[model samples]
Target chain A: MRPLGDDTGPAIEVRGLRKLYGQTVALHDIDFEVSKGEIFAVLGPNGAGKTTTVEILEGFRPREGGTVKVLGEDPFRADEEWRARIGVVLQTTGEFEDLNVREVVRHFARYYPDAQDPDELIERVGLAEKRNARASKLSGGQQRRLDVALGIIGRPEVLFLDEPTTGFDPSSRRDFWQLIRDLATSGTTIVLTTHYLEEAEQLADRVAVIVGGRILDIGVPQTLGGRDTEATVVSWMGPDGLESVHTTAPTKFAADLHARLGGEAPGLTVHRPSLEDVYLQMIGADTAATAALASAAGVTTEDS
Target chain B: MTVLTVAPARRLPRARLRRIASLGLYRGQLELLQFFRGTETVVFSLLFPVFALVIFSSMFDGEIAPGVTYSDYLVPGIIATGLMVTGFQTLAISIAIERDRGGLKRIAATPMPRSAYFIGKVIMVLVTSVVETVVLVAVSVVLYGTHLPGTADAWLTFGWVSLLGVTACALCGIALSSLPRNSRSAPAVVAPFAFVLQFISGAALVFTDLPPWLQWIASAFPLKWMCQGLRSVFLPDSYAAQEAAHSWQLGWVAVALIAWVILGTVLCLATFRWTKTRDGG
Candidate 1:
């Protein structure tokens, strides 16, 4: 991966972003920053304010109270010039009924000052064969590919994708991931939200777990919630039967087990928490209890 | 596959007037293409006026007033009704459907100006209205023996009245579309209003003996002025004897239509929404 340019400022920045629907608070006190050229993932359950945050960043919704800066400008007041620099792939694909793939992309291209060739974009999204097919005739995944093609045709500096791979089969999901990776490699900042922890782990340089309209934790995916540095589960056959214990020092425990057995420990195995495990723990219990536990365990829960 | 170079991001200048005009033209062309390709829209917009003419003309054989046969009087009224159906009803329902389906929201999220989108939509509706009018007039002339105005003065009156009437109806349609909660409810809300207006405006039957109160109510809307102005163009000067003012009242027609255009423009701008409220974050 190419190093993020240090001289350039963050691609996105938000502080105290708040949204309200009547009396209900949708997003409360949200804060985060996406570095230039980095893949940032926002992982949350449904109704967790993920879409609200993304929409606010995309300038599709108004913010009740917050300071938001995308590409060093306030998105709420930004004009078309600022909009031209950002691409958004909404959760629901827009209906372009009667328009074929090439025609739809070509039509959207006219809105931008400088847009990629429609034919080239079609090939980039692997829709070359379906270019002549009407939008309504394409399958769900194929329609999503067309959405991505339209999203990137303007060569956006920051691309916001909301649950981009929700309905895709595994193979198509993988192919879509590769397309995103290529865009990231070419220095586009990506901010994505997904219900898939594996997707966040596989794609994001850093991930933030948001629940109940609040950011619970943010860090590198592997070490989020101290999953990488926390205790490991060691399991083996004991004197009577199988035994398992959570320990901070797994290697020492295994060596001691070997010495006691006078040989190789039977069925010996060690496992660390996966990203999903860390994510679940961060968002699972009462917020106060989770915070107390993190403090007790000396795990740093500050945003990275 | 060929490797394409992805350009770096740069700050583009604001859209210039020339670019907006060209883009609006392109969007209009695409809209027209989609409209023509849809079988339902084409048949409803084109054939409905012709059908109305045939059915209404066949039912009335006597002269409506001295020197004005029922067919002659009904031709201009039917043309006015056709304009309302195509300009007002069709535009409103289509915009509602687009909003419900996320198409309008998607375009709004782009860099395109709202004015440009509105312009494109207006142009599409205007073009469709023009086509419907020509076909309906042709059918009236050939089969019903309806005579068009030969003098340039009458033609000029027809030109401005039609232009203003169509613009006002199209704008009102867009404004009224926002009252419906969803696309399904849009037709229910707009169709009844259109039907009542057509009835009161004398599109369905000549209303020479219409109640004064009802006539005042009908004159409040653009459809009434549209029908009256069209009648002035197609009916002989002597036929004006049957009118309420004993004349065509061309001046009042222009005033009422222009006032509607202004009022409708304001209402449309105030109520037009690209996305449904429930869909917003």
Candidate 2:
């Protein structure tokens, strides 16, 4: 991932934002900053206030406390011009089923002063042939592409994508990632919230993980949950069929093996926690530690 | 070949034109698209007043109160009731559906003004009601030999009453839609209440046979006054002689319009939801 620039002002800045639902606390003093022209991903399990935070930023919901500013204006109190600078692609679908793809795009293009031509945007999203087709008739991935087309039509400075590729097939998800990368390259700030670790690893300059309404950690995806710096577990086939070694430094072990043998050790492999594994462990550390004891008794425990 | 070195010229007029067309023609086209796709709504709504007119006219063929033919009295009332059902009731159902499906929330997130959304919908409903009104008028004249308003004044009255009635009902529809939990319950909840208003207050079936309390309640709703005004326009000026007073029904029209304009504004402002998802979730 490219390093996000430090010179640009924060495209989105939030401090101690809170939202309550009667006795239930949906978000408890959440704080984060997204720099301009950077792809910042909010990674979290469901019910962790990701949607709530995004809604508040979009000016659809009022926050209970703290401050939020988008593009130098307080989002909650900002007027339509401020809204024009931001684009949002929500999770819900099939709302504009009656309108054809081109019609829907053209309709939304009216909302902003500086909008791209509807036809060009439709073609860019690879829905040019389906331009005259009703949105409801489009495939799941196509609908998602249309959603992105609608989102970016406004020439928005900041885009909010909430699980944008949730129902997309692999190829479509890759295409969407490339589209996002192109937008980011052209200096559009993007804030993405997704459940897929691969999506975050591939696209995010920085990712923030939230659990139970609080951010557990925020860093580059490869480094998040300390996966990059965490100890590597080296496993190899030995006289006893297989033996494993865990250590902070794997390079020294490799050097020792090179000295012992003429070259690479037989069946030798070194692995650190995968991003998915690291994420699971970070989210369910207590559960994983407790399960380790049960697994020692020759029993496997279910995922948390 | 000579290459001319030229700076990019500003295209302000083209930009402005694009913006205007985007807001107006594009949005208008979308409303038209939704209207065409809604087949079930069209079938049920079209049959409703037509069926009511046919059934009620047949049952009261011999006598419809006094002097006036059953068709004459019934046409105006059915038109008024149809306006209520289509303009107000249908608007409510559409709004509820948009809200439930997250359509309203999506639009709200856009830069489009809330006023634009309302203006587009109201325009769509008014156009539909005008077309339906014309169709009914043509059907009445062809099948039942119904007469059109004689004077310019009568025609003027018809136009004004239709405009005001549609406005009042559409606003009332917006107000009523605010009560439903989701789009699915909208028809189940609105249909029964709407039928009650149509039969009792709309003066559609038996205006004279209804109880005094029911009459008073019906009198308060705009549908009652709208039908009465139409009765005046379609029937001879002497039509009000069957009622308590001659000019009193016209007074009712003015009063109903005022009450609806004021109260309907309050209700719409209070209940309209821009987002279906609850706060914080």
Candidate 3:
């Protein structure tokens, strides 16, 4: 559709974005980009301009001021043909009260020139049997799958999913992730905004944490929140019974302990700062002392 | 991947019509199905005009405007009322619901032209209006021996009234739809003022004997002119003997109807919301 507006362009690019709701500013100079064929996650708490930025990108909300290029075209002024090349799964969509799952998918399929077969999409979303079930009757997770099915039905080059698995249970969330992974493997650029940190860790190739209308940092989950360079807390059984040490190099500590004991270190174990720990630190939390140290060292942050 | 080529159905126009017609038919079926399933909307829409028809005709039977039978005068008025209730009132509720359910939002996100959604809704209302008119006419003929207008002029009047009535109502509906906070609040906002308008200016109240102030209010509204036009079709020439401006006052009737349609259309285009605006800030 419209030649993808220059193949060399990033999947999306936003610069100097600003939005105001009356006297309150919803977004302030927010900027981000998604390279081709990568899963980019926008992480934020509620009221963090996540929805506003995504809505503006989807052309559902007007921008107060910004330059947004989606597939190298200004999304706000893009025509239907441009819309055909991108897919958006909003927070929620209209529930087709009477139509079965298949019918609803089939109906939306007509709006696009190149649409995926509804039956196949239904199966892909793990709702093959429930395809004939009315949308209103489907369980929450199943209904969410239908939302995903509709999003992908256009066979879009870029997909924007807003908390796609927010209400999903553990098993359903996993299944939904696999579906997304499948799409990404086939070269679909995915932009996701979610509240779940673990979800970002599992799905996003690069995650950006946004707060108070600006991005705090962007990196791989392990390296984000200054996770990679942080010291690990090592614990083991000493001659006295038990011992533990917080060290920058757990491997070297274990090696020294082995020489002291003349054998393997007893009950050898190590605890390192998790991605969540580093996240809490960047957003400013008291318990992230290790994360603070990582930040101060300048070794923790990894720019992606 | 296995490649399977399917032949395009390029031979028959009838087959093409059938395929295309099915989409519209499905949408229409969905509309009617939703209408009937909602007990509150159906009861209010169907019963309000019927109650008006029964009460007014009974109260003024054989004495309305001299020679005109109350039932004869009331039937046309009720049909006009039905058009308003079904189109205008229904439009307000439907648009509010669409906003609340994110239907408008969803449609806005799609490649489908935004106008198509409104057009489809108006078409649904038009179909329902036609059916309501037929039902009212049937009941009038069966229960009260009310005659369908005999000549081509009478049919012409019906056509114009139906078209103008629906157009005005739909436009007004779209305009007023933006007033409600959500679907639950829709009735609280729309029903009160709507009933107030009908109560003051509506023809169902036997306006021939009403106070001067009430008559002035009725005269100020387009529904008054619409009802007056409908009455001209059914009531005999002697019925006009009591009208303040006797001989139908066709000029005022035409002007009021045109004014409402134009004003209503402009308002709808200007203010109708396709998506919800967060009210917190």
Candidate 4:
């Protein structure tokens, strides 16, 4: 929580990071930067090296080759003082055995130089009602909430959340997103990895898609893979029954359709590509085929 | 978005040690709570030694040697076995399970010093060992009429020997836990080995008439010395005649237990891991 003299500096910087398990490479030449106060999300399929990257950043795993700096210090060589400034929520929830939610959170709080009050953190993570419940007795989603509470209780300058909302219910996921936003607004740099595209799209200021041990692309979620400028889809019920067209200019196409119909076009809709569409395309997949499948199901790609 | 004022990070060097100690104590307390909550763990740690003492003593009413009831002689040995169970078996099995379950890995990710965790485990094991020993001794003295150590010298010997034995066994347990592939396999590997040592060391039965080679093998392990040292405190001085060396050999017992303590410490440092897949790092 220290006031960084130059607030403009990136909170995390990784360059040419490489890792290998025997002959199989886990990460190959990965590079990314997360600016201070940004919510950065890393999206990848299973075995795509997302966890490897986050683990390296959290100082949990040693990288074979890379120059990685978190909070302007090499995480691999960072001391306890350096560690005190960073918080990590691992994919696996830490089992507290007999300790209750509040006890687990409060026990972890002492490890930090500047920690949030445990009671406030439990409430912030929406676990106040379950604060006295034994950690193992809580449901999976509640345990994940406890994981997040422990992560942020450190009052870290940077927080690493590895699939933080994996088991959260829809409403709790939304609540978690709001909590993350609140943290980012308070200038806490958050780097999260998640398989949920909607989560990345909703939470990340900038997102990176990684596949096959490498980064496929990194950009603002809306603009990745030129999603913002991708040809929009125009759909309507026409004379033939239903018709849809993908065009660079949806407004002109819709107007032409309305003029041709001589009045209000039934079911007229304009839709740009969604984050999932751009993500699938960036990962070297055929989104057009998925669009066809949606069309066959009477669901327009625009509706998706 | 409301811009909240971030508090300046303050380093309280003065409170750091206090914080670490408190956290370590908290962790120890949690471990003890979990241990007592599990009925199986409580039964195994607290009652197993007492049960063994009763069954063995009732089965063998005769003396193992002159002037020493088999029941009285077995009291100290059972106390030694209690130490091994609490310090060795319990520690190894729990650590393996915790590692398999990602508990240790999660603690590694936190800013808590790794030493604090080991310290906490040591504290938990030590307290459990004390409880086990006290219960076993109290039961033996009351029910079996086993003689308690009388002199200050006997008490001092009992204190140091039990302390060193528990420390050595606990460290060895932690080191050996790293060898098991998972928690399920941990007891499979450690229990048989512990049982073999207890059997040969006369903790469960008298192995005095065994081959010299077998006696030497048992002596190489700390449990034998632990049992012998405890017997020196509780049993009459004349009971030394029944021992392998025809004397208490307290000096050799001290040397062997101390050596294990040193070796176990080194092995634990070299082999211990926060997770099963992760190495020493």
The model with the greatest DockQ is: 2
In Å, residue A143's CA in model 3 sits off its true spot by 1.5
Error of 3 at B248 (Å): 2.3
For candidate 1, lDDT tens digit of each residue in A272-297?
76676677677784443332123222
Candidate 4, residue A265: how far the Cα is off, in Å: 3.4
Off by over 4 Å in 2: A1-8, A238-246, A253-265, A285-304, B1-26, B244-248
Candidate 1 RMSD to the real structure: 6.7
DockQ for each numbered candidate: 0.31, 0.32, 0.24, 0.29
Error of 3 at A94 (Å): 4.6
Q: Candidate 3, residues B90-156: lDDT per residue as tens digits?
A: 8788888888877776656665545445656766788878878888888888877888888898778
Of models 1 and 3, which has the larger lDDT?
1
**Better candidate number, 1 or 3, judged by DockQ:** 1
Clashes per candidate, residues 3 or more apart or on different chains:
0, 0, 0, 0
Q: Any residue pairs clashing in model 1, and if so which?
A: none
- Winner of 1 and 4 under DockQ: 1
Question: How high a TM-score does candidate 1 get?
Answer: 0.88
DockQ-based ranking? 2, 1, 4, 3
> Whole-model Cα lDDT per candidate?
0.82, 0.77, 0.75, 0.82
Ten contiguous residues with the weakest lDDT in model 2 chain B: B1-10
True contacts kept of each: 0.36, 0.55, 0.26, 0.30
Docking class of 4: acceptable
Q: DockQ for the candidate 3 complex?
A: 0.24
lDDT of 4 by residue, A20-65 (tens): 8777788888889999999999987666778778878877677789
lDDT of 2 at B193: 65
Kindly indicate the candidate among 1 and 4 with the higher TM-score.
4
- Give the higher-lDDT candidate: 2 or 4: 4
Which of candidates 3 and 4 reaches a greater TM-score?
A: 4
